[model samples]
Target: MAKHYPPLPISIWRHPAHILAFGFGSGLSPKAPGTVGTLAAVPFVWLAMQYSLMPYLIILLVASLVGIYVCDKTARDLRVHDHPGIVWDEFVGYGITLIAAPDTSYALLLAFFWFRLFDIAKPWPIRVLDAKVHGGWGIMLDDIVAGMFAWVAVQLSYLLWQLF
Candidate 1:
């Protein structure tokens, strides 16, 4: 059965939290909003690459912390828990997946693939967290875990490429 959600008011665009949580309109895509939101994050990842590791980490930490609140508030306002259109989690997840990744197009593409794979697949404990957790923390935690899994995959892939 197809699930029906409440229609989002057009005025939601005026709200800062809605703007951020909806990924600056990337999440408004009619299809695959999560994928579009992740792609939207690619440019930010490019910018973050200009910073050193500590600064990049700090930025990501702040983004994650802020994401929890924005995502929660948006969900509450929409009266929907973890609505598909709320994709700031996807933005942060993609960023986390690419931390310290090589500043190359291929590397960026690889990280994107790995991040999407883990996020969509939601293996093991990620699935556990998704099922058991709730509210904003629940919305963000599973994707954060997926990002960590993708981060490991990206690093290992780079190491292997270097070795060969």
Candidate 2:
């Protein structure tokens, strides 16, 4: 059985916070850690959707604040900048994508896939920002940009699908 752990600044695999922040080792997936991390966020979104937006926003805000430090520390420990296992950025990015989205399984899944696509594509500004920015904020900003792109795509898809 998989053991639940939390995010922490020290040892990543052992820390409960790190484990949760890394999406229960989904981020550790050999291929496309970011993709796995974003996918892992789907359940949290479902739960968050049950609560008021304010509370959800609050949790996202806290993660954003701590992500800076945790990301940095994890990167240092892993000997890589913005290591894939340090996927708190993906968590926040997915949260952004889901903002105001309908509370439906399909909607959440759509947002999840779209966010993952944009994050991987890293087009235009997202790629530019990812390259230019540095440190925790940089790590977070690329995902944020990707999330914004995904958000737009989700809205457009929703409208178009409704029209059809």
Candidate 3:
């Protein structure tokens, strides 16, 4: 029974496990947890932009590697694959999307919506990849693809805005 429930603390935000398990408290949101998790990534994205592209990519790569183990472990503990509470993949995915956009409220909101749409819809290659992949990579890859699409969309939007 305990394994079935996501481990919670008296003060969920203060719990280290909760922060890790819930993707920095994003899962605690009353609305769609995944969306919340993606939204929560904006601040990190802002901070990451301070560095060069190479460093950002390195950080993402490291997160991907670590996310595999950490996500898998957390999922196993909760006895579910891609549990809502285990939102690290969403965080990473959104980070990837925001990497391509400038730091602005409009860009952030656009990236968020686009990423969420692709993620929830699981269109095309995204669906195929999600089905074929397994473990943490599986958990993260679909979102990665979604983030790619989101990035592309943001770029297009910027281009269109400039043209008009």
- Runs of candidate 3 with Cα error greater than 4 angstroms are 1-18
lDDT of 2 by residue, 1-164 (tens): 22233343455577665665566778877667788888788887778878888887888788787877666656656556666676889988998898778999888889988998998888999988988887778888898788889989999999999999
lDDT of 1 by residue, 89-118 (tens): 988888899888878899889989999999
In candidate 2, residue 95 scores what lDDT? 88
Tens digits of per-residue lDDT for model 3 on 1-164? 11244444244455454466578778766557787887777788778867888898888888777777777766565566667666778877887887757768888888888889888888999989877887678877888888888788888888999999
Q: Estimate the TM-score of every prediction.
A: 0.94, 0.85, 0.83
**RMSD of model 2, in Å?**
5.7
Which run of 10 residues does model 3 get worst, by summed lDDT? 1-10
Q: Which model, 1 or 2, shows the larger TM-score?
A: 1
**Best-fitting candidate, scored by TM-score:** 1
* Candidate structures ordered by lDDT, highest first: 1, 2, 3
lDDT of each: 0.88, 0.78, 0.75
Q: Positional deviation of 126 in candidate 3, in angstroms?
A: 1.5
Which residue pairs in candidate 3 have backbone atoms (N, alpha carbon, C) closer than 3 angstroms, thus clashing?
A: none
